[model samples]
Structure formats: C-alpha cells, structure tokens
Target: MAFGKWVKQCFESVVDPDKENEVAELTQLLQAGIKERKRSFVLAEVLQDRVYKQRHLDQARNGIYQRYLARAWADGRVQESELEILSWVSKCLDIPPQTLRAINLETARPKFAEALAKAMDDGIISDLEAAELTEIARAGGLSLPNFVEKFFHIEGEQFLRGIFAAAIADDHSAVDVLEQLVATAAKLGLSRKVVVEAIRPQAVQYIEHVLADAKEDDILTSQEESTIRQLIETFELPIAVQVYIDEELRELRLLTDIKNGKLPSIAAPPGVNLKAGELMHYHGDAVWQFLRLLKSGPDITEHPGVLAITDSRLIFRSLTRSGAFGFGTIVAHDSSRGVIEVQRQAKPVQRFICHDQSRIPAAIFLSALRMANQTLTSQDDKRRSRHIPRDIRQRVWQRYSGRCAECNAGEYLEFDHIVPVAKGGSNSDVNVQLLCRNCNLKKSDKI
Candidate 1:
C-alpha cells in the first residue's frame, strides 16, 4: 500500500463513529505513535468493542485508563459522576481492579502535588487542609502515611526542621510555639520519629550554646543550673544529650576544684610502687621520648608507656623501659605545643605526649602539675609568699596596662609568676605579670 493511501484509510477509520474494524483503528492509533493524550479518547471508544478483547490490548488499556484518571483528576478532584464513569470504563475494558488502582494512583500523583503545594504556601497545613490531604490520598488509592513517606515526607520533615530552627533562633522561650508546631506536623501525618529527628540537631545546638554561656566563667552558678534544668524540662531532651550535659558539668566541677587547689588523686597502677608520702595526682597513656645529639643529627627515642604524676615524682612504665624521677631533679618544664617537655639536671630532656581519647590537654596537665607540686611546698607558705612586693606589683601592673597579659582581660586580675616559685622563680619584677583568673588558672605551673 502507498503511504498516502494507508494514511487516508487511518484517518477514515478514526473519524467514522460506527467503524467496522475497531481493532484495525486501534492498531493504527498505537502504530502511529500519537501522543497518549490525543489518542486516548479514540482508544477508549474502540475499547468498547465487547467481542474484540485480546491479551494484546493490555498496554493500550492501561494507557487509556490512565488518561481517564488524569482527566477526572484534572480539577484536583474526582467527582462521584467521574468515579461512576471510571468504573464503567474499567468494566467495559475488563481491566483488573488492581491494575485500575495502579493507574489511578500514578495519575493522582500530580493532583496530590498541586494540593500539597497550595497547602504548604504559608508553610503550614491547617487541620482542614490536612483532612483534605488524607482524603485525596485515599481517593487516589494510597494511604496518607504511605503516600507521604513515598513522596513528601522528606520535604515535610525539612519544613518542620526549619520551623524549629527559626523558633529557637528567634527566642529560647518559644517552646510553646515549638510544641504547637510539632503537633501540627504530627497531624499532617509526619511520624513522631521523623518529628523528633528533625528537631534533634537544632535542639542539640541550642543546648551547646547554653552550656557554653553557663561555663563561660569556668563555673556553673546556681542561676545557670536553674536555666539548664528548665531547658531539660522544656525539651524533655534525649538521653544522649543529657549524657553530654552531665559530662560537661562534671568536667567544669573538676576544673573548678583544681583551680581551688583540690587536686584529684588516683591509685597507683600495678607494678608501680609509691613512696610513703607520694600521692598520685595524674595517670594516663603517654609517649616518653629521650632527646639525643647523634653523629647524624638530633634524634629522639620514643618509649610508648603509661606516665604518672605525683606529689614527689614522675613515674613512667613501658614494655621496654620504666623509670621514676624526683621533682627535685627537674630543671624546667614547657607545654607550649600540647606536649609536656621536662628538662632534667644531668639527664636528657624528656618529652611526654599523649594522643588517645583520654589524653590530657597540655594546659590541664600543667594545672595538675602545679597542684601536685603544692603538696611539696608548704601550702600555707606558698599562699603567703604569693603576695608580691608593692613596688614589683606596681611595675608589672603598669607594664601590662593593668590588663591580663594573656587575654587582655582587666577583671578579676591577679599577679602570676611567669616561672612559678615552686620552680625556683622569685617575686622579681621580670617574673611577675598580671593575668586574669581564667588565664592564670589555665597557665598553672608551666615554666
């Protein structure tokens, strides 16, 4: 057949209402590859052939039914009349109920999207709108929760998270508003798990900010405690967050106690003998290195070990080495780079470094060392001698402009020894400088 003749026949078959060959017309419609929307009406018309059913018509059946569903839902609603017509069409075409349901669901997705977009326009889905959403999903052959999980749950979760962030960012007292938002999210079919996960990050961030503010002075005052307790009651914070809070509070108390000269003591580890009066102030994993000047160059031999600091001595034990050194044998100590470096009289300078999770920070280690050394120095005598001569205090205070040398803070200022007196530093003008309490506490006894 000529191309023109075949094309002419195809048009006649489609236009004729009482066409003799319904199958041929339908075949031509499918073969011509016309867009589904344009050919769907004619396809539905021919599918009314009661005697022409075939397994080959299944694909065309699905397409035509999808078009029926899409048109019925075009106005974002499926009326009772449209539902009756759809049922008639499905029965005429012998489409399975499950297949019809699948087609409707696929067709209804866009309608759901449109409705959701409008409902979310103001960043809220009110109770009435939420009800409409449930009805839409159900009418479209989907459960509201399942549909949300498959399509809009992530977006819904993000929307709730944004509300949480904005609420907390605006003011901490917005807890009541946050509670309402959470309830609204729940009503919109978002799961409790999703809601909680959405709020967790923002809540944790707020808690951290509050903790930082409370510990700003290295002390948790009674008022700060009250505020923290209020937050806990307000949020009903999760155990993980509570654990972090407890750990931070414990560390703050420990630091405050250290600052007040109440050093913590630990029992000696196995195989390590303690002197009669020696008290263990600190113990942790450490890498001890002995410095050397070799023919090739300067070298260090590292002995990985456990190091203990005591009132009278430093003890180190390792698989390959073990030793103890009296405090009197120490020449100087420096912790400038997170490592404790000790210069010993007539012995190689040793470096103690730690890199584990429980590793001691250099500043804290120095604080412990200073507190430990106080046991050897008369605690009362050191306190009395800490008083600087008036002229020396005047010269040091003027040199730093009456501000902390370390942080430039002028409040709660105290005269600090650059080289601690226990380390043989005197109350000389050069050795004294003004440091705020916080910085001085952090500096401790490092020389």
Candidate 2:
C-alpha cells in the first residue's frame, strides 16, 4: 500500500474510551479518539476507578499511545505543547517508557521524514520550517539531527554542501558569506574537514579564473600578483594548485623582463658575426622575401635563411645572399602575418618572415631593437617628438571607441604609430591609432 494511504488509515482508526464498556472490549475499541477528543480525563478515570486484569491494561496502554501519536500528528505537525501532554498522559496511564517510545516511532517517524523532505524541497530550511522540525522531533522524543539521521545518515553532509555552494556563489571572499557558511555547518554538526571538502571545487574554479586573467597580458603586474597571492592565502589553496600558479607567474616575470630590455644574451649562430660588444639577442630559422618592381608586376622572390638580431643590427644570412642593417641606418620596421619588414635609408624594405610567426622571436627582436634605438636617441642632440600629449591620447581613445583598428577587439589595446616612430612617425593625432595586443604585435612585433 502507498505510504500516504497508510498514514490516512492510521489517523482514521481512532478509538473512543467513553463508548467502550466491557473491560475486555475496552482494549480493542480504545484507540486514537482519547487524544483527538481531548478526553484524557475519561481515560484516567477508566484506568483508576474500574478494575481490569493486568494483561488487559497492558494491551490498553499500547492502544492509548498509538491514538495519542495519531492525534498529535493529525495536522501534519506535532507541537512542543503536545509533546508535554503526551508525557503527562504516559505517566498517568503508567505506560512503560520503552513501550511509549516504540509506539511514537512506529506512528510518527514516517510522517516526520515526509515533512522534512518537503521543508528541504527548495534546498533551504527557513526559520518556520526549523521551528516546525524541532517541534516534530520533540514529539518523537528525538533531537533534530538524531531524528534526521534515523531517515538518512548523510543528510547533514548534503546540507553543508548546499549551504557552502550558495554562500560562495557571488563573492567567495565576502566575510559575511564565510561566517554564514561556518555557522551553518556548525549548526548541522559538521566538522571543518567536511566543510572544506564541500567548498573545494568552487574554490579551485575561482582561483583558475583569477590566474587566467592575470596571464592574459603576457605579464603579471605587481597589483595582479598581489591580488592572486591574497586569494591563495584567503582560500588556503593546496600545494598542487599553488604549483601551477607559481609556474605561470614565473613565465610572466620572464616576459616582463624581456619587455623591459633585461633580455639575456644567447650564443650567436654559425654564419652570424657580432661586432665589438654586440650581444646576440635572437637567432632562428626564417624565410626572407625580396620584392622587385618589374613591368609585368611587382615580382617577389623567397629565400630560406637564418635571421639574427644583435644589440646593434638585424642580420640575415642565406647561401645565395647575406645582408645586415645597423639600427642607426634603419628608418622603420613593421610586421604582418609572419613577416618583419625593415625599411632602411635609401634602400628597399627587407621582409624577414619567421617560422610559424611565433611571438617569442618577435618579442625578443622588438625588445633588442627598442633598446638600441633608445641608445641612439640619447646620444644624438636632435630632439625627437615621441610622447603623445594627454589631449591627443584622449581624442584617439574616444575616436576608436577604445578598440583595436585591425580586429575591432577591445582588450589589451595600445596606442600605435600609423608610421612608426623609428620611421619618423609623429605623436600628432593624425598618426596615432588604437590596436589590440594581437594587432599591435602583428603590426610592429611589440608585446
């Protein structure tokens, strides 16, 4: 039979003591009606004034407890006052403590379990539901956790998981949310280990998101590093996760050093010769494209070679031809796709394309070129205008809607020279444009 149907039948089988006459008849007819009708006085008189056999009284005691349980739970909840009344009724009728408990559990345990399920339907237990659950537990003569444990041993763990998840949903570092999580877990009688395990998955995801954002620019700023460090401490992240974050930070620091012109020198390639004090910054396999003007069209020729950037110049050596351009002689350089195009004074632009157009070579080459140019500018007395004034910067940002010109991307944007400063580009509004990291890197090999 369905559980609901059985509960309904149990409540309907109430027996009344006022109508039962025979001392033998009383045991069978006396069921739930005594408590439902508030006739505990009549039951007391029947037991005290009338003479009945001991076995009959024992049987009658069981009937009275069942009827009292049915009446107390008739409205789908048992109140604290009803529990007190049940205790008084049991004492007056001299029902054994074990017998009374057995009757209550048999009749009320299923009802309490069903009610608890309903209260947790929305994954929350409200104040009213908590009070009601407490009352129902008392009616069954059990504590709240003990009462729930009777139905499901892991209910407290499930509650902790749900509470922790909801608390950290918005801001994991929120003090109030943390306090609430700890308090709720304690209330459920859960340990610190269980609470930590429940929240670990979310904590890992949050840390990963923050780390990804920090690495997006290819350099970790001091502020970003500080924020990530604070998060790790706040969450008490495990060593396994900390190791990954540390590796990313190390790579970012290297990139930061490269951009700041602290790039380390490497051994020169076989065909490359360094001038006095010229340290090789980069050397790799590359394809060099030479453009020639002809009647039919602009003829293009490709040659495979090794391209090297030193502290002084860019050198490309091929089996057929070799050329070198000192930083002082160069007018401008630009990059697109996989090619770096250098225009020298009174010479055709030389385009060197690196393998796969990797950003590492591009970054090293740009950093070396920039540092060399800075040295030239500082040694020369001819003042060059390179700094963009505040007004021009504001105007350019507004005109571009703070997005890249090439890709329409909005992140990692930079102010670029339409004609590079190395090529005599000005800081005027007409020459400045916005480009995202990828577009800027493609245009000038700038990280």
Candidate 3:
C-alpha cells in the first residue's frame, strides 16, 4: 500500500456511523476540528516511537560492549584506544558511567587472560603483532582520546598501515593512498613533521596520487588544504587550491575584491520560505550517506541535497545541478541509545550519533530545532535578523572550489554556520562556509 495511505489508515480506527457523526459534530462546534484532527494524525511521532524499543536499546549497548572487549583484549590487554571507546560509550549511552569504565579493567580478566594462555604456546605481542592489534582496535571503532591522539602515532607508519589495511590495501604502488593517508593522519593526530617525513619517502606516489585525486574530485577540501599546508608552507602553492589563490585565502588569490557586508545569509532551499533569523543551531562533524528519507511509502529514492540544522528545523538543501528531491525542515529528539531520532512524516527518521565530545547532544539540538520550526506559523516569523552577515561566503567557497569544506567533495555543497545560529552566532557569510553534504554532517557544530 502507498505510505501516505497506510499512514492515514494507521491513524484511523473503524468507527460506527454514530461515533463518526459524533466526532464530526464535535469538531464542527470548535470550528478548528479538522486542524486539530490533522495534528493528532502526525506520523513522525507514531513511527519513531514504534521503531526503537527498550530491548533494542539494551541489546545495542551489550553488543558494542562485547565488541569493545574483543578489540581491547586483542592486544593481550586493554589499551588507551579501547579505554577511550568505553568513555565515549559512557557519555553516549544512558548507562551509569562507572559501568562502562569498569569494562576496561574487566576485559583483561576473561578474554585477555584466555588469549594470553593460548598465545603462550608461541610468544608475546611482537611489533608486527602489536601493530596488527592496533589495527584491530582502530577497526573496532576506536575513539582515540586526546592524550593518545598524537602520542599514539609514535609508531606512526606501522600503526598507519594497520589502519590502512582495514580500509584499503597497504601497497605503496600509487598516490591513491592519499585518501587513507590523510584519514590516518587526521585520526592519529600525526604531527606535521611526521606526516611530511612519511609522505616524503613515498613522495613519488603521494604527489602523483594527490594530483590524481584532486583532478578526480576537481578541488581540494579545506581539510585537504589544511593537511597540504602542513606539508608545505602557506602562500607557497602556485597552482592554487583551485583558482590558484596565493593570499591566505581566495579573495587575495583571485585578487578579486569582496563586498565586505554584502555576503548572503543562511539560505533556505527552493520551495522553502524562510523567516529572517529563523535558522539557528550548532552541529559537528558526522558521517552521512544518501538515505531515501522514507521507508513505508513508495521509496522516495534519494534526495539530491544535503540536510542542515536550524534553530527550529532539520533543513534539506537540494542540489543546484540536477536531482528533483524536495527540501525543508522538522525538529524533535530522543537520545535513548547514543542516537537522536527526528520524526518527519513520510520521511524516514533521521538518526545521528552523539558518541564523542565532538558531538552535541541530539536532544539539545532537536529541542531548539522544534521551537524554531514552530516559528513558521507563529509570531516568531516577525523576528528581525538576529544573525549578522560576515560576508565571507564567496571568499571561503573560492578557497575550496564549491566543494565540501572538509572532504572537498563536489556534491551536495552546503552552507554551514561556522558558529551555529543557536550558539548565538550570525547567519552572515563570514560565519559560514560551503561544506559537502558528508563533511557538514560529520563536523561538530560545537567543536
């Protein structure tokens, strides 16, 4: 059955003729009966509540906890990486923090102890073995703690190979290794000196691969630029990040002037009507994929734009190139098991992970989004531009070539408020940059 029809039926119960007439007459008396009935038929809330149950939440915790222990014990002992995941899971889940902490010490006893016994038949964690163990820890969702971030890369190359192994081959034949290399550098907080040294030895392939990847994507992401500058000095690249800018950023590079205060403000996708200052909220780096955004209805397929968080809604900005996907926003939240569920009628619930300090509480953001979305029909629409204009959008976009500010991806380029509107920042160009759908979603609005 069609989703909209099925949804309509879910809210409808078979009523006797007398009951139906009575409901109709009562609504007529109030004069807003139909409106009231529509509100009660909301499908987002009903489906969200049913999709996740207490059992599912508890099971999810148990599962991750077990996987955490296995990865921790892989090294014959729980190390910092495993310890950090426990800490993150603590903050993410509703369980007592102590329970999660205790797992660190406990993982060693049963699993590590047994593994030690089995390994005794041979030997101990050799560098190769320890390196492999590290790789396993990374694969099993290691959330490296700050203290461990840089120091953890002390065994940089080896550990990097371990990480790369999980994602792709560790072969040194080409620069396509650029993707894995940058990802590892960012994750382990590899020092610039270390990062340069590592790439220098592999420069032939690294440079070749970087150029290839750049051409493939057509631009370097802000994150990619940051990584590149770490390798070479700023104002040093002649070819430009894209437009060949030599100044700190594009305006200087293009030698083009920026109309300081004339930058564009937070934009709503086509078909969306925005009340000035209605969009405000913070977010962080997060992983995202093309979700159909609907489950029950005839598959709505994929939408062409990216989604954003405003003070009162989850906004969808469709792509400008092609793709007829629709766009708009809705808001709400529930953090039952490290995930926030956003209820949207006919749209599959949007789930975001909040397992790291880099992530803001979904509930907090959702509440603000809900209140902001309500402004569409409320006195809130009269709000003046509470957000200021930095007028730096064009400058930043030029820096990255209309790609995601982080990954430099071309599709779903979106404007992200550097400091979220909810955090009391402006909707101006200076406070925003163009981010690809994926990077914008992964970045923390708070961080």
The whole-model lDDT of each prediction reads 0.67, 0.66, 0.42
Q: C-alpha displacement of 17 in model 3, angstroms?
A: 99
Worst 10 residues of 3 by lDDT: 252-261
Residue ranges of candidate 3 with Cα displaced over 4 Å = 1-230, 234-264, 267-271, 280-309, 315-447
* Top candidate by TM-score: 2
Stretches of candidate 1 above 4 Å error?
Answer: 1-56, 172-174, 217-241, 250-447
lDDT digits (tens) for residues 190-222 of candidate 3: 554455455443342233233324322234455
TM-score of each: 0.46, 0.47, 0.19
Q: Assess the local accuracy of residue 433 in candidate 3 as a C-alpha lDDT between 0 and 100.
A: 70
Name the regions of candidate 2 deviating beyond 4 angstroms. 1-208, 222-247, 289-301, 329-358, 375-447
Which lDDT tens digits does candidate 2 get at residues 129-207?
Answer: 7777767776777777667667544665566556555554443543345456655544434455555666655555444
What lDDT would candidate 2 get against the real structure?
Answer: 0.66
Query: Residue 339 in model 1: shift from native, Å?
Result: 15
lDDT of 1 at 82: 86
Candidates ranked by TM-score? 2, 1, 3
